[model samples]
Target: MSEVLVVRGEMQPWTDHTARQPVLAALLADVIPANRRTLILGPHSPLLIESVLAHSADVTILVRSVSDAEQLTETFGPCLHVVAGALDGLKRAAAVQPTLFEVATDGVQPFEVVVAADGLDRVLGYDSEHLSWTERLAAVRSLATPDAVVVLGLRNEFSMLNLLDRRPAHLRHGDDEWVPLHDDPTRPVSVDQFQAALPWPAQLYADFSAHTLVGVEAAATARPGHLPTRLAVAALESVDTPLLTSTTEPLESAARAGLLPAVPTSWLAVCNAPTPHTLYTHSGPTTLKATATETGWETTVGVVTPDLLGTVGYDSTVVPARVPGGESVETVLFRLAAAEDVPGFRKLAAALGEWAEDSRVLLRWDDVIVAGDTFAFGISGWVAPESVDKDDLLAAAWLRFHRRLVDGHRRHPWPPWMIGDELVSTWLSMSGVTLVDPTPATAPHVESAYAEQLAWGKQLAAALSVVLDSPEQTHPDLRTQLADADRARLELTELQGHVFGLERTLGFRNKAMKTRENRIRELRGQLQKATTANNKIHSSRCYALARRLAQFRNPRKVAAKARRILRQNLNKLRPAS
Candidate 1:
């Protein structure tokens, strides 16, 4: 028997984003390499598949598993008996139409238009069991030639969460004795199953840009001709999926060995090809572990990768509902307090209950949080900082926050919330600050708080900074201090001038008094001698007069020396008044 064509299902868009991000389309444009034959298995978004098929015709497209007999019986009836249930479907289909599955579009697909739907499903990943599904898929693809690009298309059901198996909304066991796996009880209808119904002339396409990989040209005729003109299988890897050519050294492609997504026999046909168990063991969800280390505590949640399930690790966990004190867990947060409220800054702690909400409009970011006097929050999300150019949207968000805060503060007088700046919030914070450490205990709380704080803090900090740094008060304290210093200096200058003048005047007066006595004594001797007593008797009298003058004139040399000393000393003092 030729290889049986077993596919999961297909998706078609009634709306837009679905086609824009069609699984196969992305794989074709991205992960799937050029010129390779691949069998895309899974129920598909019909519109999405068609869009992928747009103007491209090289690869093969597998529609459904041979085992889905029920879906077939309900839709097509006994005509497709061999391919009824998911199991039988794969077995019989592969027998007849195996080789003609689909063709690769030479990696070239041209499209007229591509548009996004308003409401997009959350990117795939989910349920603890999904880990096995991912692993199986990877293992199956490994069987294909390493040089050949293998594309695995996931439905929205295989959500981002599916990568780990967070309990699917609904989980069940599909009968596959050969495989020990279960269906997601929560959502049996996966993204792949969600197909774009092409009624009559209506059709849906998946190319987001101007190009297309696979397009479905369908019309209600005698039978469904899934034989795509060019069966193109686009590959999908996580956005970060490494290129196969990235140096063929130990290119350890990771797979969630645990997720047991139901695969068609076509996939099982190649499962053994990758040497399934030789390289890395297929993984399954192991239970979370709670262990103690020297560093206080540690706990892991739901699923941990690269480790065998049930492997022990250290971390903390917020007890779920039935646990006491857990009910109050409104949120996890990194609290940024005002300078004054440094210690036990609990406003954010308190705000957790407020921010933890079920709406997407809310800021849902938290991943890591460094806790201390204040907290730092972070998340694991990609942001195209350069691509963001919506100033108005930023402004609008800010306005909404402020308006909300105002209403909240009025409604309930609690933590006085404040709004932050718009520009920062819009451009800078859209690419956020990552939390240093994240814990499951803080997941709900942190996620909400991170979102709220970034949105709030960016706006608040920007606005406050601008206002405080305004020309009016940027240098208030320095300007005031400078003005005071200038005034004090001027007063000191006036006082110095007055003090110098008084000192000079007092010194001059003392010198004048001291010299007066010397002058009188010198003149006295001259006056008493008069004319040496006009004659002979006077000449005798002149001697007595000369005797009196002799006391003051005894040391003319000393007197001259004293006068010189006085002048020099006075000159050393400040100028005389």
Candidate 2:
């Protein structure tokens, strides 16, 4: 068995530029093997594969979403597989590469929550006390296609250690994974189930010394683990989580799948009654009807004809759904028939064959049909049992269609029938199926009342989420409102732009005016001082000329006046000019 290596870390955040490149780069670096069929699963892996096509390795990469990858392949095109419908996308991806390396991307179709296989036994070592999961890995390898490997990628975006060190207000239980239900009755099966979800469970869970695992079977006598079923779970639940895992707690990590409550056995039993559904088979289709008056409501299941599927098409409220691409299915309308009235239902189904040409119709009468007219019919609806064989009905139709050819087979013999393939396949699928050894506890020993209470609690929680995040559900009206909100936001942004522009213009104008005003004031003050000095010098020159004229007549008087005039002129010229 090829060793499964789990490489996990906090990749870069989902940003506007590249939400998940580091994660992809890390995966491509570690997971890819030469000449091996590797399935890499992520929302953005197609984008990464687009990058990977440049590396000319002889590797065939089967992509999930073909439309998304088709554009990418123009640049880098390895072998590509893209499903038309998003729901069937992953299944097609699996067909291309049987083994998968999954990066858990939220909000993508065929949204795989877990890549872990269902069954594996934990091997216990005497010295180390670690359960060796090599057997489990081997089983997975056997189930995997030839030359393929399964790898599950995990990302812890929020560091639990960070929470522990800082002791953030949001952190719960101080970074430790706590358990509420310690003495769980079904502890035997816990490790196995938990390990199945994990790529390397035994090694990963070996840490955490706080977990003291006291075997549930030893502790509880009445539990089914001690009985013949031997089915149990080493259940773990945080004491704080059960007490305070409120509706408001953040999921914290992208890969944190919220706790999925166990399917209590009693609820399964109560839901499963051995009531066989009445079925009508024809050439093309098998129809089933089961109508029982339960809690005063008429319960029904299965289709009346080729046209009417139970809930998918019967209600006008449901969106019309179909597989993408030109798939062959004839269009026909069906009138609801009351299945409780068995004779009326049989009559309705019989008449349907006559209603169509060449009596070319097959109908599956799965439920009881009561009263119905030609145009309109009433239905008695019942909850479908889990064991209802849908493939059996399809097989019956195929068999009927095969038998039609048998009449003309003397002219043309099918080698499959003549060579004996029909016998082998049918016996394996539908020859009064029976298990070799079954236990009474496997029949479901859970109490119905307790099971109902848990289911009610779950439903209540679901209802609360719907009520809180009702706006987020992709309903038509909600989509319209969201679009309107986006438009309004754009308009507001434009208005803010205008306001910013106006503010900038005002600031520029104010600064320019202040500069101009300061320059004008300084210029005016310098001009005034220059004028005053010029005027004072002119006066001194005039006085000196007058004194010189007077001194022409009397020498002594003239000398005295001339000296005084010269001194005054010198003072005025030196100081003012």
Q: What is the C-alpha lDDT of each candidate?
A: 0.29, 0.29
- Number of the top TM-score candidate: 1
| lDDT tens per residue, model 1, 1-577 | 2232333221221111222333233333323333343433333344444443443334333332333323323543322222212212332344455444221235322211121121111211121123344344332333334343333322333322233322333442222122333353322233123231111122222221112122211101101101111011111211222122211111111111211122110111111112111000001122222222232123333333332111121111221111111101111211122233423324443333233322211121222132343222221111111222233223333343344333222232224332333322332233232232323445543443335435533443244323212233222233234556786887789878878888898889879977997898988888778656555564586777776667675488868888999999989896757
TM-score of each: 0.25, 0.20
* Model 2 lDDT tens row, 71-140: 4345444353322211113333344444443322441222111122111211111121222344333433
Lowest lDDT 10-residue stretch of candidate 2: 264-273
| Residue 125 miss distance in model 1 (angstroms) | 22
Q: Could you report the Cα RMSD, in angstroms, for every candidate shown? A: 27.2, 34.6
